[model samples]
Target chain A: MIPDDRKYTQEHEWVQVEGDAGVVGVTDHAASELGDIVYVDLPDVGAEFSAGDSVGSIESVKAVADLYIPVSGEIIEINEALDGDPALVNNSPMDDGWMFKVRLADPGELETLLDAAGYEDLLGK
Target chain B: MSDLKQTPLHQWHIDHGARMVEFAGFAMPVQYEGVLAEHATVRDAVGLFDITHMGEVFVEGPGAGAWLSGLITNSIIKGEPGKVTYTAMCNEQGGTLDDMLIYRLTEERWLVVMNASNHDKIVDWMQRHLPAEGVTMDDASDRTGLIAVQGPDSQDLVGRLEALAPHVAPIAELGFYTHIAVDGPGGEWIVSRTGYTGEHGYEIYLPAGAMLAAWEELLARGEDLGVRPIGLAARDTLRFEACYCLYGHELSEDWTPLEAGIGWAVKLKKKAGFIGRDALAAQKEAGIPRTLIGLEVEGGPIAREGCPVLAGDREVGHVTSGTFAPTLQKKLALALVEKDFAEADLMVEVRGKRLATRHRALPFLAARVKGDPRAERALS
Candidate 1:
C-alpha cells in the first residue's frame, strides 16, 4: 500500500517528502507482514538520531519489529493518535501510521534511499 | 522442509485461500479469514477445522484396556464402548509425554489421538512401555483425517450430513467425550463429541485419502450455515482462551503436570505402577518449585511466550503462551512462574515495560455449552 510519491528503505520504513523534511512511517508491507499492530512505542519529540539507527518498536499480535530511522534527524513530533489506537498504523500506513516528523539531520542521506521506481523493483511490484 | 508433512485436506485448504505455515515440521494452514475473525466464528457460530495434523493411533487386543490403563493418567477402561477420555501420559519425571484422547470403539479396541509433533514420541513411548505380545499400537495418523466442527451451531450443521444422518440422529444427543462410527461421503467414519475450543462441537475422523472429498462435501453444505475453514492460528488462540495446553508451551520434558496446574490428571490412587507415579505423588505431597499461572494484561500488546514475567522488581517467570482473546477483547498470558509468584494479580513485564497484569482464574473466556449429560463426565 505504499504510494509512488514515497521514498523507501530496505528496512521497510517509508518516507513521504513533505515540503523540506519528510513524513515517516512503516510501510503497509511491513504492517501486513506483522499481521496486527497491537502497540507502537513512538520516539520522543526532539529526539535526534542518525540514518539506519533504531527509532522505536512496532508490536503485532505475534511479533515485534524495530522501527528504523531512514533519515538522520530529530523527531519533531510523534503520532499521538497511535497511543490510543495503534491499529491506525495498520489501517493507514502511509497516512495515519505516519509515525513521526524528522527535521532532516542530513538531507544528503535522502539520496541513499530508493526512489519510488527503484523500491518497486526491490519489492518486485 | 523437503520431508515436511501435509494434511489430507491440504489442497482443500489451499483452495479456500488458506495461508499455510510450517509448524512442528508440517506444512500446516495457519489462517483462512484471519486468526481473530475465524476464532470469533468458532466462539459464536460454527467453525470447521482440518485437524488432520493430529496423530491418531489405534490399539487393540484382549490386553488393550489393561495395558493402556497403566500407561495413561486417566481411567481408560471406565468409558463404555464408543466413548472417549482425555488423559496424559507422563514421563518418569512426571512431565507430560503427550496429552491425548482415548476413544474406546469397542471393549477390546481403542484409538489414541495425540499432537502431530508428539506422534512419534507417544508411539515410541507405547512401544517401549506397553510390551504385551498380543497388543498392537498402529500409527493410523497417516491413514486417518480428523475434522472438528465447533461452536453453537455445530450439531445442526453436522447432523444434517446425509451420510451421518442414520447413526448421528440428533447430534446434540451424543454426550461430550463420546463417539460412534458413522457413514461419511467417502466411507464409514468415527464422530466424537470432542473439541478443544471449549464449545459444543464434534470431532469426525475419516479415511485420510478421502478427506478432500469429505471436507469438500461438508464445506459446501455447511457454507450456508456459516461454517468456515479455520487454521492453526485460530486453533491456538481459541485453545489459549479456553486454557488448553499446547504440547510445547504448557508441557515439555522439563515441566511436570503438578507444576503445570494439571496435577489433577496424575493418578495417585491407582496401583498400576504407571510411569511418573512416584515422582508425581511426591511432588503432589511436597509441592513443586514452580507453578503455571494465567495473567491478563490491562492494556494492549498480548504477552507472548518467552517474555520475561516480572513479579514486582524481579524476573520471576516466563510466559508460556499468550494472545489476545478475541472473545474477551483482553490480552492474556499464561506463564510458568516460581511458586512464590503464583498468586493473583501478579504483574508482568512485556518487552521491558511493566503492565498491571491480573493473575485471574484461567479459561480466560469460558464458554457455556447447552445442557448435556456429558457435563457430569470427568473429561477434564
Candidate 2:
C-alpha cells in the first residue's frame, strides 16, 4: 500500500515533500518482499545525487536490493539507528525506517513520481 | 523448458500461501510465514519440513554391504541393522559426488538418502558398478516422501502421532543415528533419529500416498506447541547454523571429505576399499590443500556464497555458504580456504568491500541432541 501524502517511485521508494525537502523511505510492499532487513547501506550526509541515481542498498536474509534516489537532491540526514538495528526496516519501514532526507534540487521533478492510485495500479500486476 | 516437478504436498503449500521457487527441478516452497520466524521456530520450539524432494535409493540383496562400502567413503560394514551413517559417495579422483545418509536396515539391505539434484547421477553411477548377479538398486525417490519433525520438543511431537503410539516409546529412546520400522495405517514406515539441523529430530520415511495424512496428523497434534510447516529457506539457515554440509555449497565435486572437515566419517583403514580410498588416504597423509572453516563477520553486510576469502591482500579461498545466522545473531559463513589461512583471522570481500572476519570453529551454534543427555545438559 502507498501513502496518499507521499509520491512513489517505480522502484518502490516513497518520497514525502515538505517544503524544498522530501523524506525518502521504501514502501511497505517493498519491505515485505525483502523479508527481514539485516543491513542498510546509506550514503554520507551532504552527498549529492541526480534523479534515479544509484544511492545505496538494502540487505535482507534472502537477498540484496539496490536503493535508488527518487528525485535529484542533496542528502541532509540519514537514519543512523539502522546501523545497530536494521529490523526497523521491516517493523516500521514507512516511519522510523525512513532511509534519509534530501533537499530537492528541482521541485518540478516531483511531478514525475507516481501517486497513491498509480502505485496501487502498479502493484496490482 | 518443461514444467517443474511438484511434491505431493504442493497443493497444501499453496493453500498455506507458501512462496514457491524452483529447487532441484521441483517447485519447492522457499518460505511460508517468513524466513526469520520459521528458522527461530525450529531453533527454540518445533517445526516440520516437507523434504519429499530428496531422493531415496534402496540397495539390497547379497553382498549389498560390501557393494555399498566400496562405493561410499564410510565404513559401512561396521554398522549394525537399523544404523544410520552419514557419508559421502565420492569419485575415484577423491571429489565428492554427494553426501548422503546410509541406513543399514539389515546385512543384506540398505537405504541411501541422496540429494534430489544428484539423484540421477548417483543412480547411474551405482548401476554402472553393479555386482554381477547379486545386488539390486532401486531409485524409490518418486514413491517415497520424507517429513522431518525437529527441535528440542521433537520427541514429544513424535510421541503425539496417534498411529505411532505402539512404536513411539522405542523411537523416543532410540540412540542417535538409529531407526525403527513402525507400522502406519497405510503401510510400514521407517522412523530414523537423524537430522540435518543440529536439533533433536526424526526423519519419517513413508509411502508417498501416506505422507499427506502423516503431515496433517503431526500438524494437528503439535498445534498447541507452536508447530509450523517450515520451508527450504529456513531449512538452509538451520543447517547452516549447525555447520552441516549442503550438497552444492560445502560438499561438491571440487572438494574432498577431508578438505571439508568431515574426515571422521571417512574410515581410511576400512578393508572394503571405497572408491576414493587411495586418493583420500594420500590426501590425508599429505594433508589436504584447502579446508573448510567457519567465519564470523564483524559488521552487517552478509557474506554469501562465492564471496572471496582474503588473507590480507592475497585471495586464499571462496565462501561456500554464508548468511546472517538467526540463532547466533551474527553474520556467519562457511568457506573453503587454503589450509594455511584456515586458522588465521581473515577478511572477506562482501559486495566489493573488505570486511574484517575471523575464522571460528565449525558449528556456529550448538546442537541439542536428545539421545546424548550430556550434550543436552551442555546445551542448557
Candidate 3:
C-alpha cells in the first residue's frame, strides 16, 4: 500500500510535496514493524536541518527508530496532535500521522527520492 | 537460520501470521497481532503461549530431593509432593547461574524446568555434580513441550479442557506453585499453577507430539472467550511489569538473587549445604552490595536496557530492564544500583539525554496470581 503521491526513502520515511513544502512521516510498513507506537519526539518548528540528518525519533513498545530528514529544509511545523496520542502514527501513517512539514531547501532534491513503484520494489512488495 | 531449532507450533504460528525471530537459538514467534495487543490480551483476557523452547530435566531416585536441595538456593526437601519451588542455581562465589522451577512429582521424582538459553550450561553443571549412585538426571527438553495460558480468565479457559477433566476439580482449586500430573494415553501431562506473567495462569507440560492438538483445542474452546496466541515480545513486557527476573537481564552471573530482589527464594539456614551457601550466607550477614529498584521516567523517551543510572553526576549502575509498561501506562525500569543509592534521587541517561526519574516500588502493577478464582467469579 505505498502511496503514489509521495516520494520515499530507503529508511522507510515518506515525504509528500505540497507547493514549496514537504510533509514527512514514516510509511505504513515502518509503523506496523514498530508495533504499537507509545511516544514520539519531534524537532522544534523553527529548526533547520540538512538532508539525511536525524530530526527526531519514534518510540514503540518494543523498539526505537530515528526519524531522518529526507530533504534538507527548515521545519515549518510539527504534528502537535501526536503529543496526545502516538497511536495515530500506527492507525493512519499516511494521513493524520504525518510528523512534520519542511520548507524545501532545493526542489531538485525531491527527484533523488524513490517513487511509489521504486519504494514498493525496495520493500519487496 | 537453517540451523535454528523450531518448536512443534512453529507452523501453527506462521499459519496465524506471527512474526518470527531467532531467540535462544530457536525460531520463535516474536509477535502475532502485536506486542501491546497480545500483552493486553494476557492481562485482560486469556492468551496462549507456546513455550516449548524451555528446557526440562527429570531427576529421579531415592536421593532426588536431598540431592536437589544441596544444589539450589532454595530447599527442595521442605516442599511436599505436588508443590513447585522457584529457586536459583549458583556458582561457588554466589553468582546466579540460572533461575528455575522444581516440581516435586513424588517422593523420589522431581522435575526441573530451566530457561532454554541456559539449557546446556545447567545440564552440564548438574551432570558435573551428580552424586555417585542415587541421583539420575534425564534431560527431556527435546522431547517435552510447554504451553501456558495466562490472564484473569485463564482458569475458566483451562478448566474446560476434556483432557484435564479427571483432574479438573483439583486443578480448579490448585494453589499458586502447586501442580497435578496425570498419566494420559498421550503421556504424562504436568499442569502447574505457575507462570512468568503476573496474571492468574497455568503452565501445561506434555509430550512434544501432543502440543499441536492441545494448542488447537485451546484456541477452539477459547474462541468465544477472546483467547489469542501471545508472543515472546509480550512475554517480556508482561514479566517486566510483574517485576520478574529475566535470566540475561535482571538475573545474571554478575548479580546474585539477593541483588535481583528474589532473596526470598534463597535459604541459607536450610541445613543442606547448597553450592553457594557459605558465600551467600556471608553476603547475607555482611549485607547485599546492590539492590534492584524500580524507576518511573518523566518524559517520552524510554530508558531502555543498558542505559546508565546516575545519582547526580556519578554513575551508580545500569538499567537491567526498562520499557513502556502497557498496563501501568508509564515508563518504568528495573535498575540494580548500590543499595545506599536505591532510595536516592536518580536520573537515567537515555540516548544522550538525562531524564528525571523517581524511585518506584517493584511490580509496577499488583499481581492477581494469588487471588481466589471462585471468589473473584462470585464478586463479578
Candidate 4:
C-alpha cells in the first residue's frame, strides 16, 4: 500500500531498488483480490529477461495469474521461502514476501515506470 | 442472468468480505477468510454457515402422516417430536428424486429440507402423491433462513449466546437427528439437532426477518473465538470429508440409492409402494450395476470432480466429489465404478496421469462420537 516508496507496473507488480539490485513482487491489492496464495512460480536464478516480459506465474487456490516483470533485467535470485509458504504474499507482500531479485538491464528504463504516488492514483486510492 | 436466487444473508456476506460466486442457482459466498483456513477452523473450533438457500417443504393434514411415509424412503412418523431423519425421496425405480432430511414435529406434521436446485422438482413430485382432498403441501422455503454452527466447539459456542440460551438443553439429551421448537430470538422455529458437517451441531430454521439479527449475534460472539463465517468452498470440503452425499453429485435423475450406498433409507418392508419402489426392489434383487466408493489418492494433488477413474487402461468411471481432504491431508475422491471394481485396490487418472489410490470406507474425517466406525479406522 506504500505507493510512494516503490515503482509499479501496469500489471500491478511493484519494484523497489536496493543499490543495484531490484526486488520484485505483487502489490497488497493484488494478493487481496486473489485470496489465498497456494502456490507461487518464480523464474530461475540467472535467467535473462527483458523489460515488459512475463517472469512466471502465481496460483491461488481458486485461480491462476501470470506474473509480469516490471523492470527488465536478469533474475539474479528467487525467494526460496515461498516454495513452502505462499501465504507470505498475502501476509506481508512487501518485506519477507518479495518474489525475486533482478539486476537492472538498463537503469534508465526505470524512469518509464510509475512512482509510488502515480501508482496510487492509477489505483484510484 | 438475473434469475439466480440470493438468500437473506447475501448482502451481509458481501459486506463481510465474502467472495461471492454462483452455485446451485444461488449466489453464495464461496469463501471469506480463505478455504483452507475456514476448513481448518471448522474442524478444530467453530464455523457458521448461511444455508438459507436449501429448500423446505411442509407436509400436513389427515393422511399427511402416512402419505409422506409412502412417498419418502424413511420412517417419518416413528420419530419423536423433535427428532430428524436423513432420508431420500426416490422414484419407484429407486432413482433419487432428492436426498433430504425429514423433521417430524407431530403425528400429522413434518418439515422436509431439500436441495436448492431441486426445490421445484421435489415440490412437483410431492404434489403428484397428495392424497385426494386429504393432505396439503406447503413450500416454506420463502419464509425460512437456516444457519448451521459446526465443529468440535460449536455446541458450546452456540449455547453461550444469550439469545440462544432458552433453546439450550442437556447436551447429551439432544441426540443426533432430533429437533425442538424453542423460544428462539425470531419466534417459534423448528430448531433441528442436525447438520451437514459430520460434527455435533444444530441447524436453526427461523423466520427470514430475524436472520440478520441472529447472524450478527452468532458472528459477534464468534469473533476471535475461532468461529468463522464459512463459505461454499469450505462447505463442499467439509461435507465431502464427512462422506455426506450432495444432490447433483451422488444422486441424480439417472442414479439410484442402491448405487449411491443409501439403500437403508428405502423402507421396502413397509409394504407400501413409492414412485421407484418396484424398480429399486428389482435392483436390490438383481444387484446394482455400479457402486459409489471413496478413493484416497497419493501424489495426485487434490483430485477434483470429473477426474477419470481408471482400471488399468480402461476408463470405468469418474469422480463425483473430490478434494484434498483437509483432515486426512491426502487427496480424496468419491467416484462411481462397476460394482466389482469398487474395492480396495484402485487407480484414478487425474490430469492424464494415472495415480495409485486405495478404496477406504467413507467419512474420511471421524466425528468424535463414542463408537464411531471412523474413529477405529483413523489413520494415526
Best by lDDT: 3
- Badly placed stretches (over 4 Å) of model 1 are B185-187, B370-380
Order of candidates by TM-score, top first?
3, 2, 1, 4
User: What stretches of model 4 exceed 4 Å from their correct place?
Assistant: A2-30, A39-83, A86-89, A92-125, B1-4, B161-164, B170-172, B221-225, B344-346, B369-380
Q: Name the docking class for model 1.
A: acceptable
TM-scores for chain A over all candidates: 0.93, 0.97, 0.98, 0.95
Models sorted by lDDT, best on top? 3, 2, 1, 4
lDDT of 3 by residue, B1-380 (tens): 67999999988999999999999999999999989999999988999999999999999999889988988998888678999999999999999999999999999999999999999999999999999999899999998999999988898889888898777789998999999999754799999999988889999999999889988999999998899999999999999988899999999888789899999999888886899889988998999999999999977699999999999999999999999898888889999999889889999998899999988877776667787532332100
Where does candidate 4 chain B have its weakest 10-residue lDDT segment?
A: B368-377
Q: Evaluate candidate 2 and give its CAPRI docking class based on DockQ.
A: medium
**TM-score per model for chain B alone?**
0.93, 0.96, 0.97, 0.93
Give candidate 3 regions above 4 Å deviation.
B373-380
Candidate 2 lDDT, tens digit per residue, B239-265?
998888998898988889889888888
Interface C-alpha RMSD after superposing true interface residues, each candidate, one decimal: 2.3, 1.1, 0.8, 3.6
Which window of 10 residues has the lowest lDDT sum in candidate 3 chain B? B371-380
Q: Which candidate should be chosen as best, given DockQ against the real structure?
A: 3
lDDT of 4 by residue, B1-380 (tens): 26878888988998999988887788889899788899888877788999999998888787886788788777766666777888888876677889999887777788889999899898998887777887888898988898998877777777776766766775435777776766665676666557877766778888888888888888788776778899988888788888888888888878888788787787777656666778887888888889888887764244567788888777788888876666776667899888878774677875456788887777676665332212343642
Per-residue alpha-carbon lDDT of model 1 for A4-97, expressed as tens digits? 8878999888887776778899877788788767778788898899888887888776678899989988888889999888889889988988
Query: In every candidate, what fraction of the native interface contacts is reproduced?
Result: 0.32, 0.63, 0.89, 0.16
For model 3 the interface RMSD, in Å, equals 0.8
Q: What is candidate 4's lDDT per residue for A56-89, written digit by digit as tens? A: 7776655568898888788998999897777899
